[model samples]
Structure formats: C-alpha cells, structure tokens
Target: MKKTEPHSSRSQQLEGAGLGFLIGFAGLLAFQLLGELVVRLLAIPVPGPVAGLLFMSVFLLVRKRTKASEPEPLLNASSLLLAHLSLLFVPAGVGIMTHIDRIKDQWLSISVALIIASFVTLFVTAWSLKILIRFMNKPEPE
Candidate 1:
C-alpha cells in the first residue's frame, strides 16, 4: 500500500468539496428549470423556486422510501448551502428596500399579513414534524 501524504488528503478533500458544490448548484438550477416549466405549463400562481422545492422534497422522500443511498455530493452541497443560509435572505432584504414606499403605504396590512403568515408557517411546520416523528417511531406489526 502506498503511504498517503498529509497535503494530498487535504487537497483531495478540497477538490471533493468543490465538486460537490458544483453538482449541488447544477441540481438546483435543473430543479428550478423544471419548476419554471411546470408553473408556465400549468399557469400556476406559485413561484418556480417554490415548485422546485416541492419537487426536491418529493424526490428526497421517494429516494428514502426506496432505500436508495443518498448521494454524498448532494448532501455535502446542501450542507454547504445551508451553512450560509442567512446569505440567501440578502436578496429578499434588498427587495424589501426597493419596495419601501409601497410597504410604508400598506404598513398595517403588511404587518398583519406577516404576523399571520409567520404563525401559520410555524404551526404547520410543527404539526408536520410531529406527525412525521410519530410515523417514523411507529412500531412494526408482528
């Protein structure tokens, strides 16, 4: 067996991470494209990115159900993205700034809507997670 150099292992890891990031980014773009097509074809009101998210979620669930091994590249990519998730909100922050005048005019409505949406999102997420946990923990029938 050949002895591995310390720098060689580190370089390999960096290369793997770089490849994982590219693959993950590509996957994201492909899903978004699929989402855009679905929305346009169906004339749906939902955003393409949201539709793409649903597609990815379904894909993950199906893969899990089929006992298919999750790809490390995808996982690594997702982890890297999630690690900097706060950065993802920067665009939305800039968008809000652009619509400052409109938001000011509709401050009350916007505030109420934001509050209600937040509560609803939190409640739904909690409920779904609870249900999923229960399902996962269910005992197998003998």
Candidate 2:
C-alpha cells in the first residue's frame, strides 16, 4: 500500500505544462485593465497600457525592496512571452499586407520618413549615452 501526498500535484503538473503562461497572461491583462482605469479616472493623456506598465514597474521595485517571499509569476510569463515575441508582430505584418496597395502609393514618403526617423533616433540615443557617461564619470565634489 502507498500513500499519496496531499499536495498540489495537479497544479504543479499544469504549471509544468504551461499554465504559468496563462496566469502570467492574466496578470498582464489585469495590469493593463488597472492602467486603463487609472487613465480614465485621472484623465491622463498617456495610454492605459503604458500607465499600467509604469504601475507594474513600481510595484516590482517595491516588491523587490520588501524582499518578496514567493516566486514572481510575471517573470516566467514574461520569459514565455519574450520567447514568442515575434508572433506579436504578425498582426502588423498582416495589416501591412492588407494595405499593400495604399502603402505602395505612399512608399517613397514612408521610406524617407522611416529613414530620417531612424537616423534621428540613433543620433539622440548616442547623444544621451554620451551625456550619461560624462555624468557618471564626473568626480564627486569635495
């Protein structure tokens, strides 16, 4: 005769089989919803998801400071999401294909705008990095 331990073996199995992804996904949605609510209530111009992300980031920082006891489910979910991040771009790719004709008409302008924006972004990022490095290297005042 054998005795089975009265633990969450079912949950453990489900988690191993990717239930963590669902929980993580749910957590993401909850944060997004919370963000949306805050944006609506505060009448902020920022997008709801962005606000939610900011909130989530602050929560993580606070949790870190408090030395959270349990494992962070978001970390696993985020890893799984990142693993298949490319899939998220499919809708945009499909949209482009759907609007290929419209895009064809504006191709040159779009190309120029994209190129200019890319260069500007690179320049700004480089400038910011230079300033940051200078600030970090500055000696403390006596």
Candidate 3:
C-alpha cells in the first residue's frame, strides 16, 4: 500500500495568509490607479490617492450592501497596510527636513494657521455630528 502525507492546518493557514496579502496589495494598487485616472480625466482638485480612496470606499459600500459577505482581500490588505502605517510618514518627514529653512522662516505663521485650522475643524466636525445625530434620531410621524 502507498503511504499518503497528512495535510497540515498550519501550512494551509500560511498559504491563505500569503494569498490574502497579495490580493490586498493588488486591490490597493488597483484603486490608486483608478483614482489617478479619474483625477487626470476630470481635472479634480483632490489628489489621486485621495480620490482613489474615495472611489474604493464607494465601491466597498456598494459591495457591502449587495454582497452577503465582507471583502476579505481588501480588509486583509488594509490591515497589512495599517500595520506599518507609520512608515508612510517617513517620506513626509524627510521632505520637511529638506525644507527646514523655509519652515523656520514661517514657523510662527504656520503654527498659528495650524492651530486655527485645528479648532475650526473640531468645531465643524462636532456641529455636523450633532446635526446628523439629531436628524437621524428624530421620531417618525405616526
């Protein structure tokens, strides 16, 4: 009789994880590409990556409503991306360092603007949230 090797659960899990990562990465790239195309074609003010994220969000929302299951590939990919999210800031940090002299020259103005913007954003967000909650929680007419 020929002997057969037993299947290992750990190997299966590892394979699934690898595939999920690939799928997730591919999805992110695809969305970014779509975003770039849309921005270029429409001359939209928003950045390509930001547009891509909006597009992806709409796509996911539609998919969530239409499909019974969650998007495993996108979720897995996003999780992987989020895990090393801080790395994305490295380039921005480097760019800021390169512009250190310019920043130093306008530091006071920039700091004041940033602080004002932060307060404005916080107030607007809070006001909007309160309005939305009130609208949503209103009792329906009998």
Tell me the tens digit of each residue's lDDT in model 3 across 34-57.
Answer: 999999999988989999899889
Which TM-score value belongs to model 2? 0.75
Arranged by lDDT with the best first, the candidates are 3, 1, 2
- Residue by residue across 47-101, what tens digits does model 1's lDDT show? 9999999998898888889976886666677788899999999988888778889
Candidate 2 lDDT over 1-142, as tens digits, reads 7989769988888877576677778888899999999999999999999998898898788888888563357877877778998999998887876788988899999999999999999999988877887789975443
lDDT of each: 0.87, 0.84, 0.90
Give residue 125's lDDT in candidate 1 (0 to 100).
Answer: 100
Alpha-carbon RMSD, each predicted model: 5.9, 4.9, 4.8
Which portions of model 2 show Cα errors greater than 4 Å? Answer: 1-12, 15-22, 68-70, 135-142
- lDDT measured at residue 75 in model 2 versus the true structure, 0 to 100: 74
Best by lDDT: 3
